[model samples]
Target: MTTVAEAASWARDLEALAIRISPRFCRLEARERARRYLAGLLAPLERKNGWQLAEAAGDASPDSVQDFLARMRWDADAVRDDLRAYVVEHLGDPDAVLVLDEIGFLKKGERSVGVQRQYSGTAGRIENCQIGVFLSYAGRHGYALIDRTLYLPQPWAGDEERRRTAWVPETVAFATKPKLGLTMLERALDAGVPCGWVAGDSVYGTDSAIRRTLERRRVGYVLTVTSGQRLWPGTVSDWVEEVPADGWHRLSAGDGAKGPRLYDWARLPFRGAPEGWSKALLIRRRLGDGELTFYLTCAPEGTALADLVWVAGARWTIESAFEMAKGEVGLDQYEVRSWTGWHRHITLAVLAFAFLTVLRKAAIKGRGPSRLGGRLDPADRARDSTPASPPPASADSRHLRRYRLVILAKTSSAESKAIALEAPYQNR
Candidate 1:
């Protein structure tokens, strides 16, 4: 259990991190603004809008908040670079993975720079929105979004007048989401970010340019591909059809909210594997519908199927990062419209997420809060931490508490089973 003092200390440490990196700002006002802004972001506000941020700063009005986002002389790109460095310094590992994904931000008007009727994965339909391609670093230490780039469709990229109004520089070009992801990957590599594998959904995986970019850099990846995606001699589904009964093995990708996600996986070798490299078609078959999902994998020879599956699982971490960031730190709850403002808001939001991630890790290390209560500590924690210590309560009361806990756990297990039976599991 994290005592009140410990939680307060953790918060102070997070604030100190913001202060330590604030020197990157050219002006003292900018530095202080960043510090307070980050604190506001981490606060448990239902709506972290400009007005709420100003209120947190004890201001009578939101004028300074509006100016801080629009006219402040701060370098958001520099802070982005620092965010990458901070993530790497804390979470870097030799076997860490770089996960690439895109998130959509819903908008009301067409003037929010890049907002238009587009297909949004979040909404599952066409919506007016802006999309940002993000790269997250995940390892044993933790995961956090390290780099971000906004995706501008060709229409916006070509419209000089719109670009002028949005303050988009003339040097910016129209790049597909995959292309932007590749740029972030290349930048991460050039920055000497340690990573062993890359993973993304079919949008990026099916792109030959993306795969070849990784190949040219000697980086390995476990990436999803469509059923129609073809190899040198055959399509992905064809390779899956050819896998014999003995080729498939049951494996757990990784632990999830429910438990380890188990699936029947098979790997089929490809024809064009280069020297010291291995390529394969990795497939997952759903137990209920026998539905198939394919992954085109490239790695060094003798890489375990378990590791490949693990890499595929690691890609989902970005989704979790996105969820936590948006839910806890108001990642998508921004009022920015210009190109620079969007980048600045996202960079700070991600920084706030990183702060929470670090605090969670400290909690897990036995010096911070437990999820059991989020307020009141659960009784199990005492039993866990004091296994060898003598009970402080009476023997009868201790036995009674243990009996109640066993019953509660059994009921919870039964409830989980009933829910799983009620709703069949899908690949997603």
Candidate 2:
């Protein structure tokens, strides 16, 4: 149950964070607004857009909040750096994993920065949305997103007129999702975010640049790959066929809301790695259907398969972070259109989310690490329904399809009801 002392402690933590980051905001007014904006995000509003947020802050209009996001002369990146440091200080673990993923913010028009009809992992189909590549820190203590970048589609990058209209900086250019993830990863490492393993989906794992960077740093990774990926001059699927029956071990990937997520697992070592380092193919098989998923692992010699499995399972932590930020802290409920507007709102939302993560960590200090206090149940998001298919996008297809259907169903019902109401009037 919630207690008065616990609630007061959380408020104190928020104040501490505000004071720590206040230096980023030059003016006293900006700092106060920043505090209010963060608190407003944490407030239980149906929609945490600028107008609602301003009202919650007791402002006469949204002008102040909107200005704070768009016109404020503060470096969101500097604030992001502070956020990374805060997360490390509060939840850092030597065995922590740095997770990379992207979340799609659904938008309707062309005005929003980085909005285009692209394949959104969130909606499970091509939609008009802005994709933000995010890096999240997942430790035994807790998890939270530490850095993010708005993915500018290639066409948007080349369109000078649209760029000017959206206030996209001239220095900004089109970068693939994996490249953005890599940039965030490098930033975290450079900033001394304590992490031993990197985990991500195929969008990142398929990129050799990311793999090479991790290998060069001698940092280990358990990144997912396509079944058709070549590991030893042969496709991974074909290579897995040669494994003997005894080669497979049934193991629990990690704990979930329900309990342990168990799957049949196997690994095949690759030939070359520097001394004391190793590379291998890690595969997971579903129990009932025997459907398979693959991952490419780079780690130190003698690293146990269970450790690799643990890293693979930990990939979901970022997904959990995305859900909590959006659902609890209004990560996506922004009315911003310009480049600066998007980053400012997103950074504040992340700050609020991190504060909550720290509070949860303190609340469950001796109770053993609860999965974000059992709020990170992937089952709540229908993750288990994801099909074990081979192509690069299949992993997210199920959830995306479900999201699309839900939106379409809602739209259809409203449209049909309106049409019925209009038909009677036209007949009269």
Candidate 3:
């Protein structure tokens, strides 16, 4: 748990960094508003107007906030470029994992850009929502958002009625999630962001073009492919002697205790297939449930087996990132109806999550928790291990506690007395 002074210092540091990135960013209303929004996420307090975020340390009014955000143009390309620069400066690693994922925001209505009745990962059902394809950078420290694009369904982009109704931008075009993902990766690479390999789930893996594009760029990748995905085994010279099999057999190497042994794989070179080809590794693994499945990958021949396994596992981090953002920080809880607001909210939420992640990493690096925990007796430690008890009825707990006091004062005579007694002793 960081102290107020420490958190304030961290906010100021981030603000300074934001200013250094682009002085104009300091003037941008979106940036200022986003900063305040992030602060609010760090320590929210209920107010008459709902939740008033932490006041900007340096006097920022709604007008200044709006002007500041407005000064920073909201173009996707520009934002992506800025984010790429940030990643290069802060988290650049040649072997970093570039994770491609799409998160859905369930919208209550159809007015948002690209909002339509569709399969929303957030809602887990068909709903009106906006999907954002994001590229995240991850390494030893943690992950940060690198780029994002809103996916416009064909009906929203192609239908004149829906387009006009949703206020879709004139330049908005329909792109499948994978296409958007590839575009994001291309932009990141073009911006010189350091990345060694790309990873994604089956949605991106099943697309041969995406894999081929990565191979064309000589980029390594580990992507999930359906067990049914067909591939030819071996090189052109080998295939010339025998007709390629429709499917190759997969074998496992390890036992259940050793983590589901997997092997019995085959490799195929792109040159041999009648259709354009990409080198692929086909693997078979036997499940404890007695099910057998195969997987395909376009990983390079020299790629270490450990590296491939790690890349495949990187997809789960994005899932955790999504869960953390939504569950912990309210990623999908925006009440705004416009596309601009939606993007703004989501961006701030990402930054907030990043801020907390940095704090957690720093704490762990300093060994703060373990060191502090060690100071306690075993009984005390066990007691602390249980879920935290609700804060005592003390006025100085936190702003939320104070707010609850104010609310309770209006409810009942006994509660009002408690509130009255608690107020004066509370520290401002």
Candidate 4:
């Protein structure tokens, strides 16, 4: 249950956020309406479309909200920059992981911007939908989606009539999902969004350019790749067959809803790492059927295998954020079809999601078990052949449970230049 004081604090936080972005809106009326729009996004309405949101704001019609989203002269990109700054202010950590992934918004019509028959993770199959490439910040305290790009399909990009009808900007061009993810990553790093590692699934991991860019910038990463991904002389699957049974170490990547996600793990150095940097193949095997998953890890030399596992686990943080944003904050409950309208609504939803995350972090602080960090008990370590490192002393040890993977995985930009990198995959 929400306490009155806590609710009041959330209100004030919302107001503060409104004031922070007020300058983006040229007109005072538009500024006020944006605030109401934000409030409506946070409201517990069944649908977050223009009608429902305006009704919740005590308006006779959705004209105000719709106008704010479509014709309102505010720059959505500017508001997004504010969202990024806000996330950093509250949840910034040096060990934070910047995660990139895409979600599909299922739409019925062909007129929606970027709508086409494509594979959407939301539906788990090819569907007519708009794909959104998103970047989320996952810090020790909490996580939130901070940046986004709508993937304009090649056909839509080439169709001038459709593009003009949807009010797509001339400056926008057809870019692969990985390229868009790369652009967002570059933007965040340029804006000084503090993070030590990057995590993504194969959509990003398969793009060698993305990996090279991170390497040049000296950022660590744990990106997933397919078993068939070649590593010089042989494929990853081929190398897996050479590993002795004793080479595998049982480890918990991180805690999930059910509990610690334990899997058999093995790591081996890969050739062709630049001088001072280390590259390795980290493989995970399911306990039940020995199913295999591979990760390409890049990090500073001497990065522990446990730390790579921790970073690999961090990729799921974005998935949970997507679920929360859509289920609680109406991230997908938009009725917009135009490019500007889509951006405006999504930006506001992102704001509302960030607000809820901050409130939840405050509500749970010092009250319950830490969500990500757990102390590994001796008995848990006893399952592995080699004894793990001594657990760090934590004030929350009383709240810490067994089988939790605990490590900072902190890497400096300077240190990252000489580190090995890892990779993971997005849900296809």
> Model 2, 1-428: lDDT tens per residue?
76686567666667777888999998999999998999899988998998899999999999999899999788888899888888887776666789999989999989898999999999999999999999988866688899988999998999999999889998998888998999888988887777788999999999999998988887889999899887767888988676666677665556566555666678888876656677899988776677889998888776667667777887888888898899999999999899999998999899899988877776655332322323334563354333323212322221111111000011211112211111100000
lDDT, model 4, position 372: 15
The TM-scores, one per candidate, come to: 0.84, 0.85, 0.67, 0.86
Scored by lDDT, the top model is 4
Report the lDDT tens digits of candidate 4 across residue range 33-74.
Answer: 989999988888898888999999899998888788899799
RMSD of each: 10.6, 13.8, 18.0, 9.4
Higher-TM-score candidate among 2 and 3?
Answer: 2
The true-versus-predicted C-alpha distance at residue 314 of model 2, in Å, is 0.2
Candidate 3 residue 380 Cα shift, in angstroms, is 37
Q: Looking at model 3, which ten-residue stretch has the lowest summed lDDT?
A: 399-408
Off by over 4 Å in 2: 366-428
Q: Model 1: per-residue lDDT, tens digit, 70-114?
A: 788888878888888877765556667899899889999789888
Candidate 2: deviation at residue 317, Å? Answer: 0.7
Error of 4 at 283 (Å): 0.6
**lDDT (0 to 1) per candidate:** 0.76, 0.78, 0.54, 0.79
